[model samples]
Target: MAATASRSASPNTPGQQLFQALRRDTVGGALLLLAAAVALIWANSPASAEYFAIRDIELGYEPWHLRLSIGQWAADGLLAVFFFLVGIELKAEFTRGDLRRLRTAVVPIAAAAGGVLVPALICAAFLLTRPELLRGWAIPTATDIAFAVAVLAIVGSHLPKALRLFLLTLAAVDDLLAITIIAIFYTETIAVLPLAAALGVVIVYGLIASRFRRFFVDRAWAAWVVLLPLGLAAWALMHASGVHATIAGVLLGFTIPAVVGRASNRTTDADLGPSSQGGDGSGIDLAEALEHRIRPLSAGFAVPVFAFFAAGVDIGGSHGLAAAFTHPLTYGIMAALIVGKPVGILASTWLATRFTAGLDPSLRWADLTGVGLLAGIGFTVSLLVAELSFTAGSVEHDVAKVAVLSASLLSAAIAAFILTLRNAHHRRESQE
Candidate 1:
């Protein structure tokens, strides 16, 4: 992933550098999977009690109600870092990347909305008989960008760039939708004072970020030394606001400048790989630089660590693994992800292109089909939502985790098989 991203941002073309950066950061998906696997194994092993104990260990500033378990910290704290990176990607895409063009952006935007809405409705349909289970409707609505892109990088390397870009755009918008859902639906209570303080901090952070964009662009450590503290304050305040702290990451990320200032001069960093070619030194803007630096932190550490904390579901716990499979929520979540996601994305994209003026000439329905399958790989955020939906040690939560893991694995497998065939077809066509 690093090798792919670093190769060259110099090619002054608009989205090339952004795409490369995305590819590079997505490599961390392998590591994230490894962490989840380790957590699962460790939780189910003889050391299961130890694993649970470690995760439940609590420490934090208690007066502010900030004290939380290791697992809670991973969800509330580390995940913010991941969301921060998402914010950066979102801003860049909308302001400067392929999403800057209405025609280019409409298909993915519609597809993402459909992808989210259909899954929620599917889950609702299955759980309609049980009002208690309806809280988890959003569980399958998210697409784990890291896991999906990682699969694409491995299996669809030969596929067209447009397909890849479409996936990225859809996932980014899907995240925004998910964040909105979290803020609106999941938050049980709101503390206006803290929320207002968090917003104030965000505004200040944005202003400082805009004024010193060139400073942070030129010196990477400045972000760590200066921006990190403000980001933390914002996150802490947001947590106190009774809103999910991760939202703070997104707000902070949006504040960072996405494009280079006309007066600034900065070359693409050497870390962008040796293939870094085609830029007028100005193309290596602040957003790209932050992405280059923070992507590793989010993918390599923040996300994987969150996965480690969140994915430690004991299959043999009170509900038992067999019972989990039989649970209605399990079936609903699995159906929503494995079936609903692809169907939603494909149908929405097809309908939009047919009815509207948004279809890209270079894209085909077959390509969109493969992309839709990949969208089904919803692992990380799904698990987070599952956790939010039910109590920590309850049967429903445990069953939901099992469902998320099974569905994500199933989706990845199906996507791999479909994309493998599509890749071969594309290769053959190219040779002709």
Candidate 2:
């Protein structure tokens, strides 16, 4: 599932080619939506039993607790690849991108926090009476970057670049918040020995990645051969430690240095090889290089596969669509996503601007509003949280999935409508 670079690439440089391929956020989002659509259709069809059977079939080494259903493998195993990419992006942002400066980073960081906190409060409010159902309060707190960016690319061609950058930074921080919630709130128990072993493996993995940066950079195969096994070992240990296995990806990502080497005034193009230069002409660090190589896998295959398995809830069950829609949990999730996300983000951004340096001058309140609405399109991490919150095959699980799917679609549609109009206005202003 390696994606070809959509933008022009240096013919000689594979690293740049991979980075260009990763720029195709639209394609990734479409594939993810298509997979979910197929899952829903298949699950509701007459052959639905076959779909569940295939998803339920178990395999793997038993003694290590590795034996899991196909659906479980998609969630616990393959989705780690997605989280690994998230980890790399977070490191890049904090070390080099918008989050590098405290003043520049404050608004998006605060907005991300507001985005998470409000939706969670909304969920908690709805589930106050039904304390048993409160475990799912985190489901609507995530923003699916792929989906939100895809919508922006489609409807915001004329919008300011600042808007998109703001969305990207906000979503990155949103993902960090979601990762923290998962690691702390979702873990029911922890095995101290396995947890400690996993951390030790992560430390060792980081040391090697840092110590031998140039060696791995020179030979792309070296990372696959050396680091892949260590990553898997850490993931396995994390899984055994009763924490979600995906946290291992974040731990490993933090170990990779975001900047490769110090910039020097004397350095020239002639002195650097193709692998050393990024698309923007900065030094290509290990984290960026690895992210480029792995993003295609994460976006094209790993996430879509996870969506296929996770999104296959039978709407034609004995309880039917009405019951699922009317479920108190469903209402909580939908409201949190469709309403709480935008309000929280807008309010937080307003406060940040009022108290701090303020937003980019080119961006208007309308643009921020659209991006805020776009953040409501929470899919991948939302589904993952829903799974973690409820037992599979239980009524609560199915209802939560229904709520997430419906809310995401509604959010994307509403955001698209608003942003498309905004795009037209911007075009008219440009012509004027």
Which model scores highest in lDDT? 2
TM-score for each prediction? 0.90, 0.90
Total clashes for model 2: 0
lDDT by candidate, in order shown: 0.83, 0.85
Q: Please give, for residues 155-223, the per-residue lDDT of candidate 2 as tens digits.
A: 888999878878988887787789789989999899999999999999999999977776666567889
In model 1, what is the error at residue 239, expressed in angstroms? 0.6
The reply for model 2, stretches above 4 Å from the true place, is: 1-23, 260-274, 277-284, 317-319
Error of 1 at 304 (Å): 0.9
Alpha-carbon runs more than 4 Å astray in model 1: 1-26, 260-284, 317-319
Clashing pairs in 2: none
